[model samples]
Target: MRDAVGRRTFLKRSAMGSAASLTPTGLLAVGAGQAQKPAAPSERVRVGLIGVGVRGRDHHLRFLGANPRVEIAAICDVDRSRADFAGQLALRGSKRRPLIFGDFRSLLDRKDIDAVVIATPDHWHSIIAIQAMEAGKDVYCEKPLTLFIAEGRRMVNVARQYGTVIQVGSQQRSDWHFRRAVALVRRQRIGRLKRIVTHLGNPGTTSGAFINPGVWEPVQTPPEGLDFNMWLGPAPYHEYSPNRCHFEFRYNLDHSGGRITDWGAHHNDIAQWALDMDASGPVRIEGKGGFNKAGPYDYANYLEVHYTYGNGIELVCENEHGNGVRFEGSDGWINVTRLRLDASSPEILTEPVSGQDIRAYDEKNKSEEIPGTDEHHNNWLDCIKSRQRCAADIETGHRSATVCHLGNIAMRLGRKLEWDPDKEQFVGDAGANILKDKPFRAPWRL
Candidate 1:
């Protein structure tokens, strides 16, 4: 996924997300539950991890195991072997071994799990996270936040009703370079914002598009330890195909929104943040895409999208701007990615941002320690104790995901559509509005 950070970055910041008020054996105070005192700074938050696949087992475990502020209380996965493997990792790192659950619901029911770290496939994100929040567990869910737009709204609603501290795993907010770039733009170092542009590489290579009309990937019986049906979760069942499971799932429209949601979850999120439109989004959208093949991998493989926010700032996300977010203003433009941050004039980036300027995150004094070095993950842990909002909170994630969703919707419709950001729906188009939510396979419901 776009969020996989190299191990070396952990020295400064690892992955990004949130934490919770948890029991020594359980969780902290949920919004709907009784009001409890804020956690003591030194109190360890008990954490349950769901989806011990690559992102969860490899990166999340690596970071959480190292953070002294958190205890890996339990792990859940539809795959028994995967669950057992991650349980061992948590056991090796902590003084106590974590409990393993074949089903995530069992883990959520535990009073000992103060917070849940969800790295499940896109289709399962909304269901698990909403349930976790309802169970009084705080959350740190990986990006794309939802399989679809409506799910994100429900996740946000639960967070509000329960006062759950849900953080989206959008770690770029924790990157110092990204933080600086955002602050510079907000400080108007680039002058009045005129346009924001972004480019994500072709979805085929980038999103692992394996199902083509000509090439067929055989569907076979699931591996011995995998609960294939459970793995499918709320999504409709397709016979087991290696091409459609785990890392390869993004290419499918049912499970993901291809590059529009994959990479857009990151850059478009940065776009939303830079534009200072975290709580709101654009009012109009139009885009075009190429879906030449009628294959198992159905989402667009290529596209360009344009959004007009109420303020008239134009945001263009296409395939040619290079892989980053660029802000073009009246005076100059600043382009930023996970790599170097550059501007039309070096003098623009050199401009100092004062206390009077917008601090995308409060990184001034506390930028080096506590929530500093490991800004993203530690920011969530710190907020868990302080009862503060995380850098990439649930609502923020929803709004950003909305940008990508709108673009994808525009591509499918191939028309200019009006969106009411306040209503979070299409102005008058029933067909486009229908696309906002998806149908569940069976017992699962949004």
Candidate 2:
């Protein structure tokens, strides 16, 4: 009852909820985890981490390793150095040695593991998540859930088909201020929502970005401990370059959608949730991009995308806004980001929720305590035991990722596109449709 839109308020009025058989019981299932029967503390959730890179080790390992009700069974990465490094940290921190794996499948093959956390590159998310779900392991996958729109659909379908308990790594959904921001917007604290703006930073300037005027990165041999071929699974093989791996991989079209899918996946996702369009998407989109003119840098150097939602709401994504989401309505506006939350009329943010007010608007929050702004990992663990959905469930993630993909498609094709969100296709453009999915490089099939 303490956070944002209390459960009943959320399911009934925001983000939509439940259906026939396949749909989630609730979109975020906000407090649904605690409402169900509790799992004994001794019943630990055995987690296997699939990528030991920055986020995998820094966040996932840090959080999961601390939870008393979870055990990190293994750590896997294409890069042995990363895997071993994180594994050592895990051992020292948790006082338990976890198996280290070069290939993700080795971790997935272990029947002892109950869930997998995928922090691999954008291209590897779909295949690894799909297999994890099919193997009956719940998943906590990082943002930009899929490399392509088609892959997002496949993830959603496979999640439903397998009854997978998945949590997308759009961690902001579980942050306290964001939860309150979304709740206030849904409650009309800002009046009828008119427009939303997100200031996602420039995509073309990632530290080691290869195409920035004066950089010469030539093909190099794969690093000693890395299995480059396995790392390239599903993506077309390209000669190794320092720019082609780690953080820099995002700037490449073959592996990512630049900031469009990277940062857009986060801010755009929050925008979708604020608009209560988690199950649906925009009807029209167009982009104006300062694409690199004389180089192979496929991503736009400066990008701005405009989307018109079915409810006649407009969302603009660009770099000028300074890295946060601002929701503007008829009366006032509310702004939020990981670091801060402020509003045009501060009174709306300062207003306190009374005990009487809680019962009048929402009751599910009265029934249970939703997992608060922790790492958002506990919500997944709780949902796994409760058999409920998470704060960032698969469908919600797919829809958010779709918003990113749509913007990327518009920018790439340099056209105004009409989309049928329900049908999951471009209205009439064959070229746009063709880009929905890319053929996975051989041997790896969804």
lDDT of each: 0.77, 0.78
Candidate 2, residues 1-446, lDDT tens digits: the string is: 22243322432342243422233434344542442333333366778999888888888888777666678889999999999999888887465689999988878899878899999999999999999998878899999898889989889888887767799998777665566777778778889999998778633231222233224478899989988889889999998887778877777778988777788888898899888888899999998877775544567667789999988999998864457788999999998876778999879887754323221122334234333334378678756755567778888899998998898889888999999999999998999999999999999888
Candidate No. with top lDDT = 2
On a 0 to 100 scale, what is the lDDT of residue 244 in model 1?
A: 84
List candidate 2 stretches off by more than 4 Å: 1-42, 202-214, 294-297, 353-375
lDDT of 1 by residue, 1-446 (tens): 11143212321131233233311111111111111223332256789999989989987887886676677889999889989989888887567889999899999989867899999889999999989989988799999998778888888888877767677888877666666778888878888999998767633232222223223578899999899999897898889988788877888877888878888888889889988898999999999977647676777777789999999999998764457778899999998766667899989966566533465633353245222244577667655655567788888899988899999999999989999999899988999999888889999986
Error of 2 at 5 (Å): 29
Clashing pairs for predicted structure model 2, backbone only: none
TM-score of each candidate structure, all chains considered together: 0.86, 0.86
Question: Where in model 1 is the C-alpha error above 4 Å?
Answer: 1-42, 202-215, 292-294, 361-373
